[model samples]
Target: MTIIRQRLNELRRRAFAGRTGEIELFRSMLGAGGVLFLHGPGGIGKSALLDVLADVAGTASADPIRIDGRDVPPVPGSLQARSGSGRTVLLLDTYELLAPIDDWVREEFLPALPADAVVVIAARRPPSSRWLADPAWRELVRVVALRNLAPHDGRAYLAG
Candidate 1:
């Protein structure tokens, strides 16, 4: 088990390059409350950054619940029940695929989450205008548009 864990950690370290700032931001936001959206074009490392955020949440003893939009059911029954009373980090990947539930999630589901629950959404585009237009959501939502790795980081990633 220890060896397996070590290998997993090593793999994670390699897979998540040039994402320290984003990971730190996610960690800081977990305690502040609200939603964080990391959006960029395909292959811009959004998924990798989400993976790092999950690991950071685990290390902080927070519950990291990952939802892949492609596989999740539309209604997402009992999702709130799983949140419990602890700090829960909800990571939503491929968010564009869940457009059918977008309104529900933004208007109803997210509002119902526990106070300590923080959501991190990764999509190909920025969040809907509604999130920014509403005074309440505007204050709560933070958007980070990811970009390609710096040349130095790219070199380090390749060398690893």
Candidate 2:
């Protein structure tokens, strides 16, 4: 996994501005089996983080099922077929694109994921009330917010 580590370091340099917080966030999310939501404003590197995660997972011999929430598929069956593969890390990029999130979460993600899968989700905002209010849904998901990078870090990321 040395190459993966190197790639992560590079991604961190270019994407998160060498900020240790984002790296720590990624490390914590790695191998974690549950729903993970990363919410942040536009231009704050949310998509870049997802790309870094996918790159790292891609290099580790781990199967990655990256679904761009912007271009979400029509059928849940296709999603299931893709993510059910072994040792898969499924990333739902820009999750807010598919709002009314409960329907998508229930009909697609929850069913598509394997018991041991790691799910990473990046969103512009948290899900709607019906989703947030559900105890069962709350039980299964971990929410993380991405604040803007510190000034020095922001400069570093922008330098690239």
lDDT of each: 0.81, 0.69
Model 2: number of clashes?
0
In order of appearance, the predictions have TM-scores of 0.89, 0.74
Model 1 spans with C-alpha error above 4 angstroms: 3-6, 76-85
User: What TM-score, to 2 decimals, does candidate 2 have?
Assistant: 0.74
Query: On residues 25-126, what C-alpha lDDT tens digit does candidate 1 reach at each position?
Result: 777887787899989999898877877788888888887888877776656463444445567689989999887778888888898887767899999999
What TM-score, to 2 decimals, does candidate 1 have? 0.89
Q: How far is candidate 1 from the true structure (C-alpha RMSD, Å)?
A: 2.0
Model 2 C-alpha lDDT per residue in residues 7-90, reported as the tens digit of each score: 776766465554366556555655666667788888778777777777777766686788876676545554555564678688
Q: Model 2, poorest ten-residue lDDT window?
A: 73-82
Candidate 1, residue 120: CA error in Å? 0.2
- Residue 125 lDDT in candidate 2: 85
